[model samples]
Target: MDRVLADDLHALHSLVSGLRRDIHAVTAAFSTSWSSGQVEGHVTRVKLLKRMGFGRANLDLLRRRVLRSP
Candidate 1:
């Protein structure tokens, strides 16, 4: 009974190890440079520019203001 339980545990560990390796390979193949940090920075800059514009600038003007200033 003890030997059977140990064998079952060993098989489960092997399966889990294979799954982890497969997941790592998949992530490595499909990752991108555009990460959460970049997205957060863009969102923060947009909000800052919107507040600075005081709700008067049109979309095109606002976009120009944000992109052209810095």
Candidate 2:
């Protein structure tokens, strides 16, 4: 009975290990080149521009201002 239980546990572990490897393969294929670091940097710049403008600008103007300034 003990040997049978051990064999079952070993089979479960192997199945879980294979699933983990497959998940990793899928994730690697779907990973992005643009990371959170770059995104956060752009967000920080946008906030600074927004604050400096004193909340009076329209979206088109703001977009032009942000894009043209740099």
Candidate 3:
């Protein structure tokens, strides 16, 4: 944490500080055999589509987009 915070990159420092819990989760995952990759991929894809459609996308459109996405 100190090393990441000490780095000159502001994005790295901010990301580490802002997503502390996520970082901890990632560290825990690294030592485990189990993976949340599929769930995470689905969530990430949906979030991006939702952001892109924002006000225009209704639930149906979002669902269609999610279904259409690889």
Candidate 4:
């Protein structure tokens, strides 16, 4: 951060100012490599399948689709 300030204080200040509220969260995310994208995708798939089955398919069919699709 000192090196960054030496090179460009304005940019450093801008970045810090922009991320002040979430500085800890942003730094933690960069330091760690955990994500919920796959879980989110599965949830999205389930939601879409449910919508597609809207009043037409029964629970059995929906269950089968979820199991088979995944």
Sort by lDDT, best first. Answer: 4, 3, 2, 1
lDDT of candidate 4 over 1-70, digit per residue (tens):
5456567568577676667668898899888889989999999999999999999999999999999995
Candidate 3 structure quality by residue, lDDT tens digits, 1-70: 7888887887788777766858777777788899788999888888999999999878999889889888
lDDT of each: 0.73, 0.73, 0.84, 0.85
- Top candidate on TM-score is 4
Cα-based TM-score, every candidate: 0.42, 0.42, 0.51, 0.55
- Pairs that collide in candidate 1 are none
lDDT, candidate 3, equals 0.84
Clashing pairs in 3: none
lDDT of 2 by residue, 2-68 (tens): 4544675776776666666698765765795645788798889998888877768778887887898
Q: Indicate which candidate wins on lDDT.
A: 4
Lowest lDDT block of 10, candidate 1 = 1-10
Give the residue spans of candidate 4 off by over 4 A: 1-31
lDDT of 4: 0.85
Q: Residue 66's C-alpha lDDT in candidate 2?
A: 85
Predicted candidate 4: what Cα RMSD to the true structure? 6.2
Candidate 2 residue spans exceeding 4 A from truth: 1-34
